[model samples]
Target: MEYKWIDNFIDGLIDVYGTKDIYELYDSLEISIRKLPKCNILLQGNEAFYNRNFLNKEVVFIRDDLNMEYEKFILCHELGHAIIHTNIITSAFSRNLLNLNKLEKQANYFALKLMDLNMDEIAFEGFTIEQIANSFNLPVKCLKLLLDSKNQNI
Candidate 1:
């Protein structure tokens, strides 16, 4: 799907926030982020989630078990939902498939854009998907999502 709107929205965020750091972006948006403690549910494969708390405050919860890089990507993904799908609660689980739905794809694209990675530039430099994924410390499937969406006219 063409997501030029999402691209523009992310660019607007970067222009306004002056940074692409997920933590800083969340802070600037007044969204609270929490780290979930290790538990049975977390062990059952929940990676992260975003929701409006009882106070109607936006909040993102990421599992503590993830590596720093993965955690950052997860945060960015949830932030996507918070900004792009404000009325919807979203979650990321290890078991979830990529490209599962329009919403998921939007969040994935948002995460990629928010990271400020120039896919065309990277590809022009002769980097393979695995190499890019390894270099960025991101999951292979996440990079695959980016690759799949690359030719979709933004």
Candidate 2:
């Protein structure tokens, strides 16, 4: 089933924050929930405990120990789940390792939406990397990388 939360988030950002761009919305989300502790453990290929979960809880547990973009994305990915996918996730599903479920997919989709963007001149006139950097307040490189990759997906 389609997650309306994602669309709701976009619409709410547009309505309340007056934000029409994806990165700007994500940056707004980051600003709204900015104090999430950064902590990361790379169990990526290990697959032992690839991630953690808090059902219906909007919290971010970023593994700051690792500095890789993937870890950052993982943190944001979990945040995406918390924001957009937790409502549909069932109690039984939350109990075990069903890492590749639909909710997880939706979370990944949210992450992808947040990360992938195109800053066109008509859309973002006089929008420079420096301005985007200032707006999101992320490093130019990080923001640029996120904006550049429009073909990636969950």
Candidate 3:
């Protein structure tokens, strides 16, 4: 379950694209982004999804109701599937399971690394993980996953 490769992949992408800005990365990679209303049942209560159409064009559909910060994280998560999962179509729905599957963890890790939040540095400055998550408008669970991954040296 080690995911250092995800970090490496993101690093290579940053090196090639010259930016960690998710929107900029999507633009440079020719990925289309669409915003959908919360009433859209197509998502099945998910926040977002990623897929390649019959024409093989990559696209991400996000819920327009999310706040700016959460929206960015959702976009980054879907972009993870676009880059990491590649051929696999994926969604960002809530899973009731305690343990996340590999793909979900990988996508979450990708979102964390892509954001380049410097969590360790921030933690060094005396901020609790919850506080950090709140300041960044990220879910505490997601931030905890990132911290756990780092703790494991992954």
Candidate 4:
């Protein structure tokens, strides 16, 4: 089943945020990330969490221990949840695992969409998969998932 709302949400983001750049989404949406107390267990294990206030202000509590690239991806994913699932102001935690649940999948699609990444721009003709991902500052594992999703959609 197609989740049409995801597309609508993307449009809303572009209209409201005035840009499709992933790095600017948080500031555009007035969302903030708090440095959560880094538990080695949580940091070493890959987990990010987000919550929305009663006033609808959103804050993502992330492990500061995460590398910059991973942190950016998590911010996008959490922003996805905040925008696409507005009613879900309740706290949620996400792990860097291949979660195929509806919400998780929607958030993944949202992240990819916000990134504005297209296969055509990837230019994989002569470059290795790692090269393409590296050039895009993408996590190889997540990029592979996006690639798979894009291919399936095509």
Best by TM-score: 3
lDDT of 3 by residue, 19-53 (tens): 98889999999998888997787566788887677
Winner of 2 and 3 under TM-score: 3
TM-score of each: 0.77, 0.41, 0.82, 0.68
lDDT of 1 by residue, 71-143 (tens): 8888898888878876553356532643448787789789987886665574548777688788777878778
- At residue 135, candidate 2 shows an lDDT of 57
How do the residues 1-154 of candidate 2 rate in per-residue lDDT, one tens digit apiece? 4545675664564688675453354466552222223332433332112222335323343433544445445545555665555344535565575555655556655554555444565766778878865554345655544554443421
Give a tens-digit lDDT track for model 4, residues 1-154. Answer: 3655677888887898688766687787778877765774534454676677725767777887777766677778888888777665342443333243767777877777677676765357888778887866766766776777666762
By summed lDDT, the worst window of 10 consecutive residues in model 4 runs over 89-98
Deviation of model 4 at 105, angstroms: 1.3
Off by over 4 Å in 3: 54-56, 89-100, 120-129
Instruction: Extract clashing residue pairs from model 1.
Output: none
**Backbone clash pairs in model 4 (N, Cα, C under 3 Å; residues 3+ apart or in different chains), count:** 0
Clashes of each: 0, 6, 0, 0
Leading candidate by lDDT: 3
Better model by lDDT: candidate 2 vs candidate 4? 4
Off by over 4 Å in 4: 40-46, 54-57, 89-100, 120-141
Better model by TM-score: candidate 1 vs candidate 3: 3
CA RMSD of all predictions: 4.5, 9.1, 4.0, 4.7
